[model samples]
Target: MPKEIKNHICEEETFTGIYSKYSKSLHDFLYYKFGEYLDPNDKMQEAFIKLWENCKKVPPSSARAFLFKVAGNMMLNDIKHRKVVLRYIQTKPKEYTNESPEFIMEEAQFFDKYQKALSKLPEEQRITFLLSKADKKPHKEIAEMLGVTRRVVDSRVYNASLKLKAELEEFNKFYAKKPSKLL
Candidate 1:
């Protein structure tokens, strides 16, 4: 075999060996952290691709870290991109409270207003809110997904809740003043 072809074959074997040793744990860790919004299967593939691409520089001892670092950054970038797209694209709004609406018109209006308010939030804060409130992910998991510290995730969740609460309260006040047409 030619020198380059032989070198490539050896590199492929090393990459496969590294993946066999670490892919499962790496995928599990990523799933726990980013499965809510990120695609675990795709991210796993990307990690392997990055590992192979950087195999020459990444020592075997540090391969795990390299895979995680690459995958984590890819997930974060995906989140940021999705956040930007979601800002312009409309989606079904979440009901903050369990209280039933008196009628269809009132229900529709409530959802519309709630969605508008949610759309106004920054993308990062909105993602933090979704992970905590919508997906019920733990702080550490969210922190890992976003490549941030757990404390940062905690603060983001806290602030998001406060903001949502205030917005809902205001919505309630406005809704209360409207005539009871639905009833």
Candidate 2:
């Protein structure tokens, strides 16, 4: 009778043996050839995973070469991806802004607090303030639009300003000290 041939790594024992035999060498090969930055350990594990996935298609004798080839190809693909990323970064458009990150953050906080404070104002005061400042309507125009006297419109705007300024006193002090620091 002829000796039984082991033609594939489909069996768990055969696959595990192949992994035990090749994993370390494959990892070392990748590390030596590509350096540690490319993550040889990860590549080795992924190569093993690929081998397991294709175990029935591979023979135990060829498993070492298969793992090395798969891991090397993975490293090459990673290098290619890095090159594409570098190229994209080189070609990316740059937009310059006069404002610093701190300035932008502070501005956003100021707006948030301003909106909250604005919303908390009396309805008449809020409406008058919005019409005068947001709409750029004068006190006379606001009075006409709201059917109120000019004095009432002025009073509402003045009261609203006082409330908003009082609520935002911290921002005012911060803003007062920012110009010199920014320059």
- Candidate 2, residues 38-144, lDDT tens digits: the string is 99999999999999899867767778889999999999999999999999989956688888999779877877777799899999999998888777789998999
Q: Estimate, for each residue in 1-183, the C-alpha lDDT of model 1 and write its tens digit.
A: 365444441276767877788888888888999885587768988988877777666676678888889888989999999998988587767867555656455667776766777788888888987787668788899999999999888888778767766877655454465424211
Off by over 4 Å in 1: 1-10, 90-183
Report the C-alpha displacement of residue 118, candidate 2, in angstroms. 30
List clashing residue pairs in candidate 1: none
Clashing pairs in 2: none
**Model 1 global lDDT (CA atoms, 0 to 1):** 0.75
TM-scores, each model vs. reference: 0.43, 0.49
Alpha-carbon RMSD, each predicted model: 19.4, 12.0
Task: Give lDDT: candidate 2, residue 152.
Answer: 100
Which candidate gets the maximum lDDT versus the true structure?
A: 2
